[model samples]
Target: MKRKLIAMLMAGVTAVTLTACGGSGETSTEGSAANAEGDKNYKIAVLMSHQTNAFTTAVSSGAKDKGTELGVTVDILDGKQDPNTQASQIETCIAQGYDAVLVEPISADAIVPAVKAANEAEMPVMTIVQQMKNQEDMAVSYCGGDESKAGKMQMEKAMEAIGGKGNIVVLYGPMGSDAQLSRKAGYDEVLKNYPDVKIAFEDTANWTTEEALSKMETWIQTGTQIDAVVAQNDSMALGALKACEDAGKDIPCFGLDAVDDALAAIKAGRLAGTVSQDAYGQGAIGVENMVKYLNGEEIEPFNYTECIWIDQSNVDEYIDK
Candidate 1:
């Protein structure tokens, strides 16, 4: 065990040294910032894609709680679901000499340059919930759900509920975002098996309830039969559900991120079901991994939490967690 730990520490040191040597001659103090302050006193910056809904907020809450428990300072910066905002924030974290950074990216491709800059500065940037482009080269590690798997599970369940044959309206997240792309990939994979199920209408809601409501209202006006609503996230799911209810159109809705509201809706028999990805757990674990990396300890390149299916039959088992 001691030898293995030593090997891990040596590998980390070598990587940092090489990266730091290749950087512009200006000295970067981030490497020693945590050590100088002593263990458990390091500062970490958590860059969230956005806090527009409960899921992102829950992730930040968990990170903050873990930071407190670990006796480290954790600051969360909102990106407002804008790649530019996230990139700007990453620059600020680098300038502020933070010990580490955790990012929930707004766009996988758009966030690459910022991540590359962090890498050039020899600042460890870990991704949570969403991935940046070339994740293996850009970020130190990733901690989140398997978006494709989650999408697959969500679509499969929705198909099962609808008997695999119906017209469904798909509400998407921000296009080009990691979750949006990967989850949709999962959706498409399942869709290949259900030839009778057609996508009646689809559009991007940008992961907001209001946006989803507006989109659904517009789609409803088209007068096309929508049997089930499959949303990438719960906020959009609830919004789509609301539009159907207001229009007196009964439709079964499925969503990911089994948030509190979604869970309540399931128990109330308003929602069909949702896939539960532990947003809070993802945040907490990301912070934990950051600490390990900072301390020259071994950390997994990919840390994924389990995604569970929740409906009235199993909603009780997941209500509190």
Candidate 2:
């Protein structure tokens, strides 16, 4: 009887051991399959500053199109020009386990910590338009139009229209933005070549048409002889046009970003020209580069798209009427 009881105990132990081992093996196999499924599904997140602007809208559209083409599940988050919000969105993307992050930073410095966090989490971060101060280490790729070159080209067209000498009013955008700073640097460089061209009044319009209109109106009230207006963007240029019309001043105007309104203004001869920086291309390239990096391909640190000066002489050809 004692031997039979011992035999029964041994059998029970063997059955339990076998059951546990089989269950463990099944779990391990399922886990491997789950990991494989996760690998096959790519997730990408794109964070942009604002969508109200035409340029940003085009960029968003381009990113969506490219992401769809590449079979990526893209999550687009709009910061609405709020830097802190943008940073938070990046962190959320990281927490959500995105494969890659493509950002058009509202401010370079504000987004660094979030980008760093993503990097630490092993997520590839790509910057568009604006670059971080320590860009070499922070971003996998920096892709966009060269703001400085665009600004310089626009200024050159303005100078050409004004015979290289005039009293110029500069309508700038937000103070610390990379685009604004680079564009200003280019404007300054071009202005240096024309000593006779005096800056009548230079002020920030905050990249808004309303603000630009108010600022230009104030400048006009001050009795400044503004022969030409160099608006950092077409929206502000349109605002300046309103002010100029109100004041009965027919001074030539120049703007960046060949927006539809700007193109129309150019055709109407109200504005001289603008530099066409393809925002759509910027967005498309950002996603494309992220995809390439994921596929173990190297990407350029700096991807600069060319700019074209759009003026009355050639506006019709480029404008989609």
For each candidate, how many residue pairs have backbone atoms clashing (under 3 Å)? 0, 0
TM-score of each: 0.87, 0.85
- The regions of model 2 sitting more than 4 angstroms off are 1-39
lDDT (C-alpha, whole model) for all candidates: 0.82, 0.75
Per-model C-alpha RMSD: 8.7, 17.3
For this target, which candidate reaches the highest TM-score against the unseen true structure? 1
lDDT, candidate 1, 1-321, per-residue tens? 001122222223211111111123211112322332265577688888877788898887667666655556677777877789789888987887878899999988989898888889989999999988899877889999999999999999999989999899999999999999999999999999999999999999988999999999999999998899999999999999999999999899998998899999998999999987788888878987898898888888999988888899988877754
Q: Residue 125 CA error for candidate 1 (Å)?
A: 0.5
Model 2 poorest ten-residue lDDT run: 26-35
- The residue-level lDDT of candidate 2 at 116 comes to 89
**Highest lDDT model number:** 1
Candidate 2 local accuracy as lDDT? 0.75
lDDT of 2 by residue, 60-162 (tens): 6666655555555556677778888788877777776778888887886787888889989999998887677678898998898898998888888788878
